[model samples]
Target: MRRLPPLNALKAFEAAARHQSFTAAAHELNVTQTAVSQLVKSLEERLGVALFERRGNQLSLSPRGMGYLPAVSDAFDRIAAATAILDETDARQITLGCGPTFAMRWLIPRLPDFQRAHPECEVRLSTTLAVRELQSQSPLPDGVDAAVRLYDPSKPEPGLMADPLFTADLFPVCAPGLAARLKTMADLARETLLEVRHAPGEWRDWLSAAGLGSMVPSSSLSFDFHAFALQAALDGAGVALARRPFVTDDLKAGRLIAPFALSLPKGGAWCLLYRPEAAGGSAFLKLRDWLIGAAMPPTA
Candidate 1:
């Protein structure tokens, strides 16, 4: 027989520890703050150790709590995974979480191939601007099975498995008419420079890579999302820095042209991330293999 605290107490403790706030944990668990506090206190008394240090309004994990968190979290994750396997409702469906930009410009375009290959497995995509949230959330929000993120592989997050998809290569791209005007690097000064608000450094990186760092544009336009910036560029608003994978179809269709030969490789690469246990599941493995195979270069 296994000795364990009440499941509610464990859950309350875990939620409080993760957020470091009883109020936030209550919000997450959909219970009263006082209830969360009582549950955590009950858990602490049962364990015979202080799990958190209360400093006035601030809450932080005690040394014992720090040591206990990973084990507790992993146990919960395992329970969730086991339950998922036993639950027949989700057996044929795989939930994928990804950035809105990637979903719109890259993943959605290639989804048909995946559907064709696995007609039995339904790929349910969820888009969010907060990619980190997808990885950090406990109980894996809305039963998300996996995530595709543009993140640095060298600096991986704990408790998640990451598989590299592709490195991003950025170059300036615009409509065909705009391309005709950009004969030289210095010619960028005559046009409006388009920028994605979230990735303003990409333009600077591309300029530095092309050795045109001194060139300044006459005007500039900024958009909150890459898709918006790319659309503005397609409308001849200005030249936008394009990630190759996102703009491949546009370039091939002659809707967007890369006038400069120079391209800058971004510091991060696109990758698939998921819990370690999920990696072994047949549905996830199929999707992972398909994604990696799709990223491979075609044979001559």
Candidate 2:
């Protein structure tokens, strides 16, 4: 039989030791700091060894703990990644990730077509809200195959492989009702513009490029998600200057309308992200091809 510490104790130790703070560890494990401390204590008692030395509200890994942590971490990460792969029996799972706006605006509308093309593939969509939530993404969870991501290509890699998918162009959009009320860029002062909090400086940069540098509207609607911003447009809340792919469905459906003929090409690009170490996955490849089909331009 395999000799092992209690699963909870091991998890507690990993989280606590990785962060060097029981509080930070508790946040990841979703347990009380005191509970995590107790679990670590229980583990040390069971093993008859001190894994960490407490030093005035902080922790330092003991000599033995320092030697043990790397191996234990690698083993757990491998077990988790493998279990995720083994859970898919029919090769039907693909864990997809994208910004809320991209998913709602670009991918979700086209998903049914994908289902028809490959009835064997089941895509599990995950809303990865740009870069802010990148770390929240775990190795494709048990059964999650792959993910699509939107990122700034100029930005450094965050470990995942980034593949060029498409260039997302930013433009001003509003409810059809609101669109009728606007006459010129100067009319923006009378309206509330929905801005993405995460993509700071984008609105200003676009406006400045248009030679309207001083046209900062006094009122605004801010949201962290593209989805929420789009929702605001649908509800006639305000105008949102968002990427084209993310608002394609709403624009096509006439729930929203483009007020400006000029579209600003953004610095960010859409990417197909996957673990470099993942073994060849036939199902994942097929899904990647299907997405590529939709992203490609007609002339290309």
Candidate 3:
């Protein structure tokens, strides 16, 4: 027979450890902060170990807690995944998580084609921060069926499976009006550089590739995401670095221009990521194949 702490206590402990705050975990679990605290205390007493360290206002995991979390989280995830397979209410609707810009500029537009191909399936998108992969210790969030993002194969994540969808090549893109001024790479010094806040080093990488290692833009503007940065460029605010999937339509429509032939490969592929369990589902497979097909370049 297996011995276990109270399921409610385990839930409280997991949520508190993840957020590092009783109040935040309470908000998520829809319980009082006092209740969460008591449950965690009970769990610690049951285990005969201190799961968390209370340092004034900051709460952190103890060494035992740090080591204990992954197994606990994975157990809950397995239960949730098993439960999800039994849920038929939304069987045809699959939730896909990705960055907002990729959803807006790339995925959403092509979704219509997928719908045309398989009208029975519904693709719902949940936008996440521009991260390369899910946090190492965290499971795929409860509601997310799958996710797609840039994945560096060099850093292999054990539980998740990744399938390459697109080779994201980065290059400078700006409105046609700004493009004319950027006739030569040296002329970049005359223009404002639009940058995404999370990827501050992109401009430096592109400049080094162009052999203008020390060059700086006349001025610079920063946005929280690539979508905003690209929008600023579209309004002639500045030149923003872009990947092919995000700019293909605009570049073809003459709304944007890639002034230089030099494009830097991201040293990674934008890949579809999911747990091993979801691989066999027909709905998941359809979406995966459609995404892969949509990302392919046109054939002559």
Candidate 4:
């Protein structure tokens, strides 16, 4: 290692040289003026050079001190910048806002994998009603670094950038017992129809696709959220209109059954939404990439 002057001495020299006054340097460094003078004197003694010209009531750098200022100042600036970066990275917590159903049905189960992979970054989740989020004119609420929501690219939200994660395909699903009662798609007309009130047209569209446009269910139940509707269906309350992402696990585990093979594409996609500038942050990018990867189909 190269020999260097004491850090305190160097700091005193730099500060005193910059202001051309030990009194001013002492004020900035929170030290006594005598201490600043002693530190600078020690630095000068070590360097074997007179660093300052001592004229009464005036202080000025010598030729050698003038030459040293730029390098010392640059080194301190670089050190400050590097420390700031370290502090920022160490404080890497992302607050994500999403709908309750998406959080419950899709994200929460898979979050452990993300946590395992990036222990340095913490993810705090906040849930809201999808209907309110979709229809709100304001930006994401305070403390929400980003959001995941259904977005129609045809009608983009102002000042927001969206990265599509998954498209939801709608299908009918219910408890296996309720499903067994239904022999075919046309048989759905005899049972209660379950729906989320915000997207009331989904049932009609699904019916029309199944060639039962004129058919109406024996009765109906409407909930405020897809999660509630799906839960009701799980309890054998009725046949819920299931979205692909929300039902994937339940369908595979036999918790719910889709009797019909038909699945209709919804109008928009579930996407990650954020301000355009947030895309540049490393924390956001990591979360975004992980979400996209999680949404991908498994390989054979």
Which candidate comes out best when scored by lDDT?
3
In model 3, state the lDDT of residue 213: 95
Better of 2 and 3 by lDDT: 3
TM-score of each: 0.72, 0.63, 0.71, 0.67
lDDT of 2 by residue, 63-88 (tens): 98898789789879977765665556
RMSD, one per candidate, in order: 7.9, 10.1, 8.9, 11.9
Answer with 1 or 4, whichever has the higher lDDT: 4
lDDT by candidate, in order shown: 0.84, 0.77, 0.87, 0.86
lDDT of 1 at 268: 80
* TM-score for predicted model 2 compared with the true structure: 0.63
* TM-score of decoy 4: 0.67
* lDDT (tens digit, per residue) of candidate 1 on 1-300: 999899999999999999999999999999999999999999999999999999999999999999999999989989888677545556667888887878888789999998899887788888753455534653234467888877777887777788888777788899999999988988999999999877778888788877878778899999877889999999999999888777878988999999988888777888887877776566677888999898776688
Q: What is the lDDT of residue 42 in candidate 3?
A: 99
lDDT of 3 by residue, 248-286 (tens): 889989999999999998788888888877765667889
Give the better candidate number (1 or 2) by TM-score: 1
Local accuracy of candidate 4 as per-residue lDDT tens digits, 22-90: 999999999999999999999999999999998998999999989999989977875664354346663
lDDT of 2 at 233: 82
User: What TM-score would you give candidate 3 relative to the actual structure?
Assistant: 0.71
lDDT, residue 250, candidate 4 = 96
Q: Which wins on lDDT, candidate 1 or candidate 2?
A: 1
